[model samples]
Target: MTYSLSDFGSYWAGGEVLCVTEGAPREIAFTRDARFTYDPRGDFAVNAAYVQYFVPAQAVDAPPVLLVHGGGMAGSCWETTPDGRPGWLHRLLDAGRVVHVVDLPERGRAGFAPGHLPGEPILRSMQEAWTLFRFGPAEGFADRTPFAHQQFPVDALEAFARRFVPRWQGTAHLHLAAFLAVLDRTGPALVICHSQGSETAFDAVATNPNRITGLIALEPSAFPDDPAALETCPLVIVQGDHLDSADHWRTRADRWATLADELPDARLIDTAHEVASGGSHMLMMDRHSDQVLEATLGHVRV
Candidate 1:
């Protein structure tokens, strides 16, 4: 299904902008024979990070909410559900938020092309998502039924699978560069990022704490290099369920929990413990997304 990004919110007006970034030249080896043969275009290349604004009919006295998606995903991740239902973008806008959904560099509508990015695209296999997202029994992904309280649109799993973007690994620097560009144009915003996207949000806050008023990380997989700097910004860490079993996320969650304790304005919101229905890693797309949305909005309002 095709979606017009401008119609993301229940707002009076909205628009889209392509944020460009100029950076220092970097060496690139195109082939085995070519050494440090960089593109002659200099540093000013059009980044793929697209930003959209949704202005509400009644303006709320709050910073706009900037929605950033996780790895292997794009700005479309927050636009709609696999089952063709309203998504977080709509929910936030209805709640009186000026929303900005971003397509990070090399992902989504952010002009992703082969050789444009340094690395190969990271494609998520069905099994990888099934196991990593904690949809069902990890042992037998296809055989086991999804959690009875699953918030994800499991019946329309195929649609969800198709939402995955052609994302590149080891491009956090590039993503951050473009993210900073968006932040510059939007002024202070409440950065709501998920998983890998959290890295850019965290770094953006540290880079310039004044640019971001608040930060909400949903199942953050990456962390801040300097927690001391991040502590200045109001931060909310949302950890989804089933993390205790996954070693990869288990340690990361624990580390962030510890880091949160050290920060004055930082707090961790464990969705697993917040609601009886609980939530998976992709809580925003889960069945109880509304509940999680309210939880996040609470922090943003603070």
Candidate 2:
């Protein structure tokens, strides 16, 4: 059965409206609290990572696809396109594959506490995403000039930006534990990940290759210190344009270059080099996300 956007966002927990404004023009007086550490701050409750598993009614024998978001973002990345269109979450499900979308620990509805989670939130600015995400030139970010044929909806930048969550740097182990738990329940599956979640993907795939059948990393980094183990599982790195400079892609080239030499079995695909229509770093959210999704599905089913 096809899942609706509301169906994906229905899971809720771990917060309350402690105070509300009482006056002619009512406003939120304040919230209960953003921080929820192990040591209770006042009848606090922690939420499980919100995961929506979309399994087609006529299921394929393929392994389930686990969709993980990058830093400063939540599982909503897969829910819908900036332009109010069905995103990869729906596309993959329609392709007859089971897909699991996640809001990892301390993100979205997963719950969080500042000092308690072992690291602080790395707040991101609009310009940071604009430039870093390869939307366009630095000046264009301020002026909102998108690259020619850019897929991301400029109109939805505000909503897209809202999904940015605070990244927890020192909590890979926590993410790993959560991922492992998911795997234990789902059984071995194909793990598709983005930027920061790459770390968790590699670690999980490496430590338990039997549980993680494959990995398709999009503009990913933080590859395991030792990538040799990644060879055990099917691996593919799908990279998009580094329009600004080689700095971003250069570092990635160097890392993957080394991995390629060491493990000739691993594969890499540069979208700009192959596809007639190039994509940005946030390729999956772009207008032609299906092209990249096509490349992703090709390698995963095995």
Candidate 3:
């Protein structure tokens, strides 16, 4: 179903803007097409998460859903699929659910401060995304030889790669702070996190479980250090296909399963094992994303 601005009643955003470091006082000037000239030298605000929220005309009773994208990606990943189909954000909005999408600090709309953070930003190549995302093997990445059950719309892989952005490895703590600040604004939310974002999600909920009613992890790459901290929060862990075929994914999946087993309120959804397969790491953008999301939401009691 198509929707317009009329579908929503209001929208807003909030997050922490941190300045870990400031550039030396240097005279830097710029102009906009020579029509406007201005001096741009000042302390740069770094590691500020960008959050965009949409409130429907009639919202469901459920808590707002917080959608956090994986590493090297922005919140836009939840807005639309590479094939131009409606993503989880739109689907949730269509279902009368309030939705908040977050672009983690140091990425996307949340600009990064050069020379502020420790290490340089790492850029993900097309081949890396092809393989790391479980669409295909590393050797066959150049040829784009996706597995038989690949469901990431391989034809649009190039378009999807466009979502890739430079990500910092040492800024997890900063991202965590910004995420918590977001929760401080939207109380008692249901967080749905993907990949590295899952790490921050786990940390956020662990730090403030009362603010987060539930969490849905999408192919999470990291798990909480203390599982007991998340005992009160409802958890759902979802994984895609071919995990056993790759050590990188297999280890993480196994670790996540172990974490689920330890948590009293945690549920595991291995799409490959439970369903008819064809699910990729990018489960939200997969061919059967609608079903996947529906099933996941069914498990989220809060």
lDDT of 2 by residue, 99-173 (tens): 888777778767686535565678788888887887777889767997776666776877778878777667777
lDDT of 3 at 119: 79
Reference-based lDDT, residue 42, model 3: 45
Q: Put down candidate 3 lDDT per residue, 1-302, tens digits, no spaces.
A: 75443343322233334443433444434454444433334444566678888887767798989999998999989989999989999999888888989888878887777666787888998887887788887877777788887888999998998889888888888889888888888888999999999999999977888999999999898888788999999999998888866788778888888988998999999887766497888999998898889889889997
Regions of candidate 1 where Cα sits further than 4 Å from its true position: 1-44
Deviation in Å, model 3, residue 82 alpha carbon: 0.4
| Residue-level error in angstroms, candidate 3, position 80 | 0.7
Order the candidate numbers by TM-score, best to worst.
3, 1, 2
Q: How does residue 46 of candidate 2 score in lDDT?
A: 42
Q: lDDT values of the candidates?
A: 0.76, 0.73, 0.83
TM-score between candidate 2 and the true structure: 0.82
Alpha-carbon deviation at 140 in model 2, angstroms = 1.2
